[model samples]
Target: MADGGVDEDEKPVGELFGRLIDESKAYAKAELGLAKVTAEAKAQAAKKPALLGIAAFLFLQAAVVVLCITLALALATLIGPLAGGLIATIVALGIAAGLGLMAKKALESGQ
Candidate 1:
């Protein structure tokens, strides 16, 4: 036996190559397993924040709807129910269209 602990008759080239390949496969499998566990942990950490964000978004949407209804009703007192509702609808649609165009432009620029 050599000081390095290898036999004086070195391993054949094919045998060494096979060992290397097996070790490489084992290393790759370990890395993949670690990555999967890391991803799962990150997802679990984000789950609560993601749910809270969705809830906040829904609440904001409700608030916007309430504001629109209030505006329509207030206008109704002055003008009339039908005309007030129409005006409110038109205003909301115009705002939505403007925001949509802005969002589209932003996305296009980012891409």
Candidate 2:
């Protein structure tokens, strides 16, 4: 805007630096906010109950398997070996089939 150049005394360095500092502060604040949001999002995802529920469910299934094996072994010892083995196999297959059917139905129903 100056025809050629202005005198050095007329230049306003203070105003220029003031504006730059304000813009820098705003940018820094915006970056800090973004980082905070990202950290919170990660923490919330980790804290979700779905993960706990899944771990609990897996523990329950493991307990059930151990119990079933113990019972089957006891039954086999009390009864004849052949009959006990056959009975345990049948029961295991039946449970597996039932679980498969339940899972299929749940999937079909979309929850």
Candidate 3:
């Protein structure tokens, strides 16, 4: 050993290590930014199909409503409005009562 065992030649190696650390951090930041952008794009892409599904469901509901109206109108044509209204109300009530009775029976049997 010479000059009291002091070393100054490792300074360049330390600087190079520091630079590598900084560069690695910058690369990781860039990759994270890219991932965020990709996720946003995928989310946006998914929204269109979701909206379309909602629109389709709404349209189907509207079609069912229209079909009911058409049936009511046809019944009105075959019978007078007063009689058609009475018959439709009776039919709906009968269906409801039947369903209720069936549910009661099923519940009683289960118990």
The top-ranked prediction according to lDDT is: 1
Clashing pairs in 1: none
Question: Tens digit of lDDT per residue, candidate 2, span 1-111?
Answer: 455587645669997788889999999999999999999998899886878989999999899778777767878898967777677778878999999999999999998
lDDT of 3 at 9: 58
| Predicted candidate 1 versus true structure: per-residue lDDT over 66-97, tens digit per residue | 98899899999999999899888999999999
Q: What are the lDDT scores of the predictions, listed in order?
A: 0.93, 0.85, 0.81
**Per-candidate alpha-carbon RMSD to the true structure:** 2.5, 7.7, 9.5
lDDT of 3 by residue, 12-47 (tens): 687779988999999999999999999999999999
Q: List the residue pairs that clash in candidate 2.
A: none
Where in model 1 is the C-alpha error above 4 Å? 2-9
Worst 10 residues of 2 by lDDT: 1-10
**What is the model-wide C-alpha lDDT for candidate 1?**
0.93
Better of 1 and 2 by lDDT: 1
- Which order, best to worst by TM-score? 1, 2, 3
Q: What's the TM-score of every candidate structure?
A: 0.91, 0.48, 0.43
